[model samples]
Target: VAAGPAPPGTAPGGRRPWRQLALLSGLISMDSSESSVISVLFPALRAALGLPLSALGTLVAVGKLAGMVTGPLWVMLAQRVSRKTVLVISSGLWGVWSIAAGLSQNYVQLLILSTIAAAGFAGGGALVNGILADLFDDAHRGRAAGYLYAGVAVLLAVVGPLLGLLSEVHNGWRYGFFLSGAVTVAFGLLVAAFFRDPGVGAAENPGVGAAENPGVGAAEPHRGGPARPGATVLNRAVLRELMSSRTFRLILVQRFANTQLAMVSFGVVYLVDVFHFDNATASLVSAPAAICFLIGTALGGQIVDRVQRRLPDAGRLLTWQLATLGWGVAALLATQVTWPSIGIYVVLFCVLGVLQGFNPGCNRPILMAVTRPETRSAAFAVMLSAESAGWAASTLAIGYAGSAFGLRTAVLWLVVVLNLANALFMTLIHRPLRREALALRAATADTHPRTSGAENR
Candidate 1:
């Protein structure tokens, strides 16, 4: 496989790359905050509506289901239109739905509005992951993902306290939702007006190759040539090719199993219910964990990148991924034991946060390595859809289980078992990774002969 020279914006560079990273991270943070905010505001929402605790599960499940359906559609739209255009439109529209959700008069209306907002939120991961791959080549992807996700974690941490305060007010949760929606809408417009779309394979086709195809990232029609060939084409054959990869399928399954943790949707609730912390205290306690998560994310990404560089054909990335999952399983299992004090629990939470941090840096880099650029968005769409299904399944199951068996028991049981399953599923990806990595590099070279030629030179 042609592992050509490192592409542009792939490593230490100027502020432009950081600026792009910050913008994309901010977008994702906004989307992620929606999911977190709901959890923080759940108790208040339930009290106001006179709803049972189980309603939270339904709320989460419905949103996940909606995301499952719409994720692929966004991928298809991005294929036909500009990635930037699709993202701007989806983000803007969803922001409207998000705001309207706050105004819902009843449970059903709230559910419906939240689901609509989720449908728009679902598209973000597919678009952003695909775009990031183009912005930074393989060498730098780990650190880039780490920084992006760390920013998200930090941002969410910062807002969690505010949301907690909102929960104390009679109708304050509504304002939190309204504020989130308006901010997202504003960011969406900013992205539309200012965000530049890096070419589809711009990182891989650096130097003169990239310059020759300045229009690669846009929605404009190809002129006097066959369609510009890259890895991210949308069609049956491409889909089939993507599906055929055993590593990719395993990656998807691992993702599915991981989502079964359901922590993101219910973590704060677990802390409150099990530890007897009030809303504000629960949110505040979780804040430090987010900082730990950020550090772990940054450190883990750097370690994996260094490991891969030193052991190119040794499959160190797989080792790091599996290790991260193993750590997660252990940390989660530790949470099952009733802790003697809040301090001990916070320590466990921080450990879990670090484990959680390891994943973001590893997962997409694996996907990008095993697949080509044209297939990347489709690959992400499928991945996101599977993740949504997992989220729906886990949220509903845990939500109901929590209502019956107790939140702590239900969450702990699921986290331990499902993460173990995910780790096992990831093993199947191990043997195939080298082969897939070679295939992706070969395909990239084949798709862009100029890149191959430059590598040869």
Candidate 2:
């Protein structure tokens, strides 16, 4: 398919966003499958390996920490090489190792393999967003990102219930991880063999031997002055650019808060412990939350493009997240009720889904706005690194808090605090978002135009 790089002020429903969404969808299946498959198997793992809850908590913490450790290396590399290369190699390794994790016999082996697999998690988030940044001009970034997250939502929807049902069958847990790994590997191969760098004009790649076609447009200009693939994280200027942006800070800070709350959703054991459900039952029950999340994401993705047309500010997006956070907190509070019915539990699961849905849809717009095209990947790395730090900190703090104060009580407090913090950070970021977006718009207007036929109403 020929890519139509419409000049600025082009009509909606073009080809780039669709292609990019396809790319993101394929890549995100790796992540969603990894999480869902394991979430379903956590019970079987306990019996097979004699792993306890605290040990399980430690594994989750370590996986996230691996992302923190490896994110910047990928970012710096993206500046030097194609972000496309970084994503494929890293995520490919993630998929290969994730399968190995399923076959591990001992607890320590699982830990090691999981840590390696998680390393893929860090780099791709920023790199994929960077690819989308390059594909769509700023005017349609919200729509572009919305479409990307919608893909992720779709994958999550499939992974959740599919894995849950599979694990529920006897010995199905053993096969679930293996099949999930095969699926992820297939997706990776598709990306490696068929996926071109989204930022590059199709004319340059000519995957079917068309690069020789003189008609293809000249390779688009590269980001960050064409650093080699081994670029170091010593760019003081990039650091300054990252730190100076108030919006970037909020995105990072709220990532921390949101991740902290997300840590609770990982508590599938709570279903077993409090609700008196078995492992398979708990896993199946939690699938509804994932479904709700995907549904909400689809709705959000469809609307974001329209919203950007009219209310192009970050506040409108934040308002949606704040409401979601509030809903999740209310759901957690409901769990505290004595003799709660299954209906209320289902509603709370939906609440978790709602918050997950709102986050990726709303959050990416704020992230894309603050940084310009030149160093968007590195800028994302900086924010993601900060988020990782805050996430590591909060996970430790909250994990201990849950242990001491009781999981239910600790979570209730955390939901209130983190959402409050998320609200404050969003409010604090207004000037930066507006200012930087205007600057990005001005800079690109000559080349790309400044409208996406947005339909805010």
Best by TM-score: 1
lDDT of 1 by residue, 392-427 (tens): 888888888889998777776676667776676666
Candidate 1 yields a Cα-based lDDT of 0.73
Off by over 4 Å in 2: 1-16, 166-174, 200-234, 259-267, 446-457
TM-score of 1: 0.90
**Residues 1-457 of candidate 2: C-alpha lDDT, one tens digit per residue:** 4334444432122233465467766686576566555555666666667876555556666777888878877777665655556666776545777778878878898888877877776777777766665455444555566566666656655665566676567656557667767777677667776555534321111121112321211123323222112222427887787778777766676676664344443446666655676765666545566667666666665565556566676544654556555765755454566455555666776776666566555666667665655566676677666766665565555556766776666555665456555666566667777787767555544433323222122
Full-model lDDT for every candidate: 0.73, 0.59
Candidate 1, residue 114: lDDT: 89
Candidate with best lDDT: 1
